[model samples]
Target chain A: MNIPKITFIKMNKKEYILIAGLLILGLLSYFFMYNIEPGAMVKIEVSQKLYGTYALNKDQEILVKDSKGVILCTSEIKDGSIRVKSSTCTDKICIKEGEISSSGQTIICLPNQVVITVINEKEQIDGVLK
Target chain B: MNVKKLTLIIISSIIFLSLIYFYMNRNIVVAQTQFIMNTTIEIKLFGKNIDKQKLVKTMNRAFDIMKEVEDKSTSYVEYEGNAASLNKHRGEYYMVNQDLIEQLSTSIPFYKLTSGEFNIGLYRTVNIWKNATDKNYLPSREEALNSIGNSTPDDIIVDKFNNRVKLPEDMEIDLGGVSKGYALDKVIVFLKNSNIDIALINAGGNIITLGTPVDRDYFNIAIQDPQSINKILGTVKLNNGQAIATSGSYSRYYEINGEKYSHILSGNSGYPKHLYKSVTVITNKGIISDILSTSLFLLSIENGRKLIEKLDYPVEFLYILNDDTIIKSEGFKIEYSQDNLYKDE
Candidate 1:
């Protein structure tokens, strides 16, 4: 009985270098896409539109305005957390919600149609039950 | 073939295969948020083979389902075949949408289970309180008591065959307690039918998971502290087909004359009971979780346990008492955050 033998192909030094380079490129891209450093940015959306994203490290007051240039609310980012300092809405529930420092935490002012969410690249929690 | 040519071919094929592998294994997540049912409704879809556009379209369809439920169940606005219309034609058999009939019929049994604590027939009482809150004054005790009509869910005549319903005289129905959960259930059905797995729908505070996450065994859901707005009480792990719903008095309330009144009004007393600051329930069904959370929040701790024992569906509960005491079921696993203030009971 005759048996078939499998033959393997051997690569030269240049080919090996090319393969290694390609593998490194793939690994780098993978890490670049997935292993993002947790950022401290808070995204403010007004009426379902992306109003702006502000860094949490900055201690500044953001005056969220409407389309007609009317200031709806004032949000303060202090000590790596943000809170609604004041608002023109009636409920004032947004002001009472207090400060949110963690990723995925949100302070929603329904009366003014504004939602401020802490946006981190690596979110600690998928969703929050309020 | 020459050795050099064979090496070049092998390297090219290796790179090609890796590219295909990466493309096929790409995990795409699409999330969108819309304000519906008086709160934000966020739909998140997770899949390997679907594109972002398709996922977003599916999410819009899911939001449409929720909007349909809101249109049918909202008492604030009167639609053709919604709760408002039914309330308008009380004491007579009014033809309505089949979805409303199904929702009412499904919720009626809970009225008996909770002993009228979970009543949908408190719209009039709700309106009175809402009006009082808007006017910045408290309603008179007599006025609030008179608004609490004696109509029970038993008096609701649901003619399934005709797709119509009749409410007892002076009984107004508000499906606020179950509408969000009902919408979640409907959206889940639609998502499953679309052959998309591993999704999460959060209608305000009520969250439902379709399948386990791609990178994790279960979805990590953080329960907000009722005492403090920024702090979390703990984190709970929810597996596939499980939902968590919370009814917290601290989230929604009206302050009138230096007094706070929660929106969660008791069908029996026509007043909000501060048995617990927040009651969270985990169950297999979204509607059940929603209904049980609200019902259990209104009941005492002892009575709430009794109600849980009587239910056939598997459920886990966590109660945050007014004094910052946390009580959880034995099977519910929660990882307390560092610096957790609540004392475990």
Candidate 2:
């Protein structure tokens, strides 16, 4: 039978300092990367252009306008949800769609070519099927 | 003995490890939303090694493919050689693009498969309802019944070799039910050929998944409640290469004299049926999922089951009745939202 001898290497003060510095760097990076939470925001786009973004926490009404400065639709935010109050389009589907609070939900007025979506940094659902 | 050299090696290793960590955690998701086919078409691509500019180009091409399909299949607009033209020249053989030819050939069989319940020749009937809705009047039952002339698959002739199609003299074709799904299939093929493995395309309510996401086994899809806009009924786990489509009467409707009529019309009655409030189908092919969702919505639970049984491949379905009774296939798993609005049957 043959016996194998195991040796252990001891680290000095400089090596301990390097290890501690690396750990601190990793922790700082992790916190900086993920700790900041931007609340849910509503993104309104007109004809594929970013019209504006508003915080869901605030209760306000957003009037969407086209290139000619014509009002297309008015969306209202209340109780952390948003809904289309009125629109210039023939079909009131956008108004009938009611309120949407969760992320990834969209209110699209095809005639006006406006799309309003609620966006959150950490979206729970990948997509919503209507 | 050389402390500075040891320190240099340790610091370099830390930097190297950090690079590896960041790279390993980098999962890029590129998504673009465009309005095409009268709905929002969102294309999402996922990967670890994605070139953002190249991915955007691919997405644009995918949207172009959908636009081409729409231009060819739309009954509202007339292109030089498309469905609108074919509808105009009914009873005469008219040459068309090969894509339209393929769509017709693929969809004509479903008309017989669903026993005429799934029909593409409802253009006239659809127009009647559209006009009625615009004028805020209810079309007479007799008018709807008369508009559905001879619209059987046997009446439509497709000369595949010549890329020509001829509709019956009285029949007008509307590819609304299958065009979006066909476009989805086309885009998926284009993406796969472009070496895109993970992607999700949502055209209106029709969704198709490519490979699985980087972090999850399947995509989490939430089915919206037909009764409520803010609430979702449940979530379905869609696996790779699977497509899910929902046909709900609540989405688009015609309201006349305080009554709501669904957009999905039945071939027999030439009017929307209230058998189910919504029907959802999950299948392997996007076109099949689209066709079945509409067909099953018009069918009874038993008849739909029989139709599914006759098919060679597997299919799962979910039905939400008027009374909020939820019926689903055995293999279809749904995580119901914690709401008492719907009851599982």
Q: Please report how far candidate 1 places residue B87 from its true position, in Å.
A: 0.9
The C-alpha stretches of model 2 lying farther than 4 A from their native spots are: A1-123, B1-25
Q: Please give the RMSD to the true structure for each candidate, in Å.
A: 14.4, 14.9
Give the true-structure RMSD of model 1: 14.4
User: Distance from true position, residue B172, model 2, in Å?
Assistant: 1.1
Off by over 4 Å in 1: A1-123, B1-25
lDDT of 2 by residue, B185-293 (tens): 9999999999889999998779999998764689888899887789988889999999999999888788877788999998866899988889999998998888889
Interface RMSD values, listed in order for every candidate: 4.2, 5.0
lDDT of 2 by residue, A1-130 (tens): 8878878678889999998899779766754443112238899999999999988989999999998899999999988889999999999899999998765678999999999988874344677888
Candidate 1 per-residue lDDT over residues B1-345, each given as its tens digit? 789989998998898788756754467778889999889888989876677788888888988999998998887789998999999999999999877987898899888888878888888888888888889988877777678777788889999999989999978899989888888999999999988898999886799999977656898888888868799878888999999999988788877887888889887877888888889999999988989999999988788899889888899999888888889899889988887888898
Local error of candidate 2 at residue B71 (angstroms): 0.7
- In candidate 2, list every pair of residues with a backbone clash: none
B25 Cα displacement, candidate 1 (Å): 7.0
